[model samples]
Target: MKLSVALIEPEHEVNVGHIARVMKNFGVNELFLVNPKFDSKKATIFAVHGKDLLTKSKIIYFKDLRKFDLLIGTTAIYSNNRSNVIRDSINPSQLVKIIADSKQSICFLVGRESTGLNNTELSICDIVVSIDTGTAYRTLNISHALAILLYEIKKNSFQKKTNLATVHERVLLIDYALKLAKVSGYRRHKTSLLAMALKRFLGRNLLTSKETMLMVTLFRQALLTIERKRRKMF
Candidate 1:
């Protein structure tokens, strides 16, 4: 898996530098900073060997999250309530399981130091992850949390040699699937849920470019078939 780290509006330059150092420790080179508050120069003092990352990090927006084939969000706050799906999260080990065999490009998003990822950002993520503290103190330092995540991923997961579908291709396939769902008589509410559910299925499992294309074709053909039958009935 091609892994990247994205810090969403990081508040402290020290944390950014520390996280970058940890990322380099785990062999992760790509860093993305979204609307950061601290100066890159200040952070480099802490980075030591990872000083280049602070200088070379990409600045991105919230909408740009979709550019990643799989986006994993980190949250200090999570709930057991089934109704609260946005905060529902898996542990870092579970995250390793999800990406162990996939060649897809993945990004792990770390939120602000004080509040963590908001509901809107969590909803956009393919999966939300929380490190198990096994105690009352659930929140961890931003750099520590990021270190745990990257260490687990680097230790457990291996990059596979496969021609996986790009984020754009998978997104197009998802849109086509939603179209197929609408034509197949699924209710609007169900279609929305299907969109979320489909992301888990498509993102966790590795699909080759050819496999994704086949699925898209099947959806289009089904939609066309439904349209023809409807016209004949009219």
Candidate 2:
């Protein structure tokens, strides 16, 4: 499984830099930032040996979540607001079990320092995860929370030793699926949901190189067949 960390509108540049360094410490390379309040100079100073991660980080939007197969949202809000079931979360240990067995690109989303993720973002994520802490201190800093989650991910995550579908490959497949949905007369909203669910399934299943290749071929064929039928009708 490929692991990535995403910070959403982080408030402090120092935290971003620290998270980058922590990510390197635990062997995670992909770092994504969304509408960040990032200061390159401070980030550079904090990153140290992990400057590479800071340099290669990606800037993304909430809608760009399709790139990750499984998204784990981190929040301090637990038990108090169980009424919103979507915001209810699993602990790090449970998250470890899920990632270790899957062959997908997983992204852990850390919210802004002042406030954690809102209901809408958490609702879209595949799973909401939290770390257990002392009751007196319900919250942790962004980098601290990031470090703990990354450690758990590294501890029990899938060992990548075989050929598997890459993020690029998965994106292409999802594109074709959207086209298929369009031809089948599905509405845009329903098609989007289908794309989301399908992406999770593809990420969850560990496909070998050969198996991935076969899937790509099959999706391509399906798209071609649809185009041909449309042509003949015209």
Candidate 3:
């Protein structure tokens, strides 16, 4: 999986340069800027030895971000008023585990230096990630956050063996199971419960496509048995 870091309307050239330096340290090549405020000189000075990253970086519009498969936004604020869902931000180790099996291109999105990602920008992201900071001053510099997140991601990338199931395959398996339950005359309410139970059961096992297919066949057989019993009763 390819990983890229994206900065949305960043205001500080120094932060951009520092982030580029960090990206190079972690072996991350792609850098995307959306409407940045400064020119190349400011970034180059901060980049130090990592000037090539800034030179080759892709500056794109917000609309073009759709090309990436997964977008993870970063934020520091936790206001109840915000519409975006705030979940536990994964530590570097955990983040690596989550992406180990993912096949899609991943984008790490950082908002402007002055203010973090707004609600609307956060909405486009598949998930929101945050760095753990001291309560005395919870906010981290944009470049610092980028550096830490990239370091963790790179560390995890090297060690993880990617075998986790894809979302599409899991959905297909669930659909098949639901169809089988319906054919067996499971009541609508009962079917919902059953589906939930089955989902939990399957989730625990982390079913692969082959294992899921085997379960599907077994469920079909169970449905057939239920149908035969119903006919006998009639």
Candidate 4:
């Protein structure tokens, strides 16, 4: 699993630098900044040994964020009745569990220091996670938020032993299934439904590369069987 810490429209140079430090401490290397306020000098001072994270960081527009499969936006205030899944602000352990279950690349989004994520940004995230804090004013500095999140993500989760299948691999699986469905004379709508169902099922399994290859082979054999049956009908 590739874990990235993404700061969106950060307004402080010191904060960006500090967040990079925390990311390094927790073994997180991918630092992404969107519309940052400061240059490398300010960030380098605070980053200490983590200057590499700053240097290698990817700067991107908001639209490019969709490339990540799991986007987690951090917020201080919970919008009542807006989300389908609500839990008490996530503790470090809970954060680990969520990450363990996720099969795709994960992005942790930290908003600007002055305000937490706006409604527009939160709408795109799959989950809005909050750090549990006792203060009446729940806001945390952007760097502090990164520290908490990185600590949770790095601690206690099983290290990924094998690389995840790429997007191309997943697409190939879907395309193979679609072709089989077509030859079976399945209706177009039903074919879409069946393909989606299969995708969801595969996603839930979090299949390893070898496992995915095996499944693809099985799917191929099933398609051949269907084709044979089609030939018999002619």
Candidate 5:
């Protein structure tokens, strides 16, 4: 398994530098900055031995993240309400278990220091994971959270087995499912929830590339059939 880190609109140069250093410690070479607000030169000063990592980090748009095989979002907030599907998350240990034996390149997305990832941003992720601090003050420093997550992933995860579906493939599968639902006359609001739930469900389980394609083919066939039937009736 290949590991990488992505900081989303980071607010602090210090945090950026520290995260780079942590990534180096875990043997992660790719650092992706999404609309970062920090100065590169200033952040490099704090990177110390990891200065090269900070200097070489790629600046990318949010949409470019679909290239990775998996995107694991980090969050400090936890929610128990089933209706609040976006805020629902798994712990770091559980995350290690879920992807332990999977062969995939995974990116860990860390949000801003003050607000973390908003509901819209969280919804974009395949899976959202929260670090269990076990305190009323659950918020963790951006670098600290990355350190914990990387450490757990490094210590517990091992590579083996089939290639997992890339984020782009999974996303296309979801889009086809939604299209099929729309063609089948499902309600608009209900379709929205269905999309959210399906994304999370797919993230929780490891799906081989072939399996994902099979499912995508199923949805596409259903959609085509529905459209043909409706057109004949008209």
Candidate 6:
């Protein structure tokens, strides 16, 4: 999976430079800035060896986020008062599965240095993740949170398949399994539970298209056999 780090309306140039340094430290090179408020020299000084990263970082608008398969918003204050389902943020650890599953582009979006992502930004995100900082300090430095999130992403990124399963293949695996289950005498509720569990299991594993197709073939064969037996019984 390709990972890009984006800062939106960042007011501090030094932090942006420092974030670029940490991104290089973790081998993340794609940096994006949206209408930043920092000077170039201050950024170059703090970036140090990461000047190349800062140099290549893109100056983008929010509309440009469509370039990614997933646009993730980062927040420090994960309030329980999330107005709706889309606003709720998951823990960073839970995001590892998403990184492991797809071979698509991802953008990690962080808002201004003074404040975390606003509701409007968060609303457009595919996912929102928050780092857990205890009550001592409710929020984290934008750079610090980026470091933690990047570390988690890098940890799970080592799992490589020759050809990773696409979203369609992933969905089809469960669909085929459910058809096989229903035709082979499983109750609807029971089959539903099984499918849910299977989806969870499959979601965490790095499966290739060939592996998924093999399972699909097996399920199809089983369903055909079940159909023949039912015809004879009738």
| TM-score-best of 1 and 2 | 1
* Number of the predicted model whose TM-score against the real structure is largest: 5
Q: Over the stretch 57-150, how does candidate 6's per-residue lDDT look in tens digits?
A: 8899888886665678887766675334444667778878656635677788988988778877876666778777767576888888888988
Write candidate 4's Cα lDDT for 1-234 as tens digits.
Answer: 678888888887788889888888988789888888777788799889999999999889988887986667788875444222222144556557655735578888888888867867865665567876887877888788778777666556565535555555665777887887788787886764565455444443445667677767887999999888979999
Model 3 residue 51 distance off true place after TM-score fit, in angstroms: 1.1
- Per-residue error for 163 in candidate 1, Å, reads 1.9
Residue 127 error, candidate 2, Å = 0.5
Give the residue spans of candidate 2 off by over 4 A: 80-82, 157-234
Q: Specify the poorest-scoring 10-residue window by lDDT in model 3.
A: 81-90
Tell me which residue pairs clash in candidate 2.
Answer: none
TM-score per prediction, in order, is 0.85, 0.67, 0.66, 0.64, 0.86, 0.67
Give the lowest summed-lDDT range of ten residues in model 5.
157-166
Q: Arrange candidates by TM-score, descending.
A: 5, 1, 6, 2, 3, 4
Q: Which runs of model 6 end up more than 4 angstroms from their true locations?
A: 157-234
Q: Ten-residue segment with the worst summed lDDT in candidate 6?
A: 197-206
lDDT of each: 0.84, 0.77, 0.72, 0.72, 0.87, 0.77
Better of 2 and 4 by TM-score: 2
Local lDDT at 24 for model 6: 90
- Candidate 3 TM-score over all chains jointly: 0.66
Backbone clashes, candidate 5? 0
What RMSD, rounded to one decimal, does every model reach?
A: 2.5, 6.2, 6.6, 6.3, 2.6, 6.9
Q: Is candidate 1 or candidate 4 better by TM-score?
A: 1
**Which predicted model would earn the best lDDT?**
5
lDDT of 3 by residue, 94-152 (tens): 56656664656789889988887886676566556777676757689988888888777
Q: Candidate 1 — which residues are off by over 4 angstroms?
A: 157-161
Model 6 residue 157 CA deviation in Å: 5.5
Please tell me which model should have the higher lDDT, number 5 or number 6. 5
Better of 1 and 2 by lDDT: 1
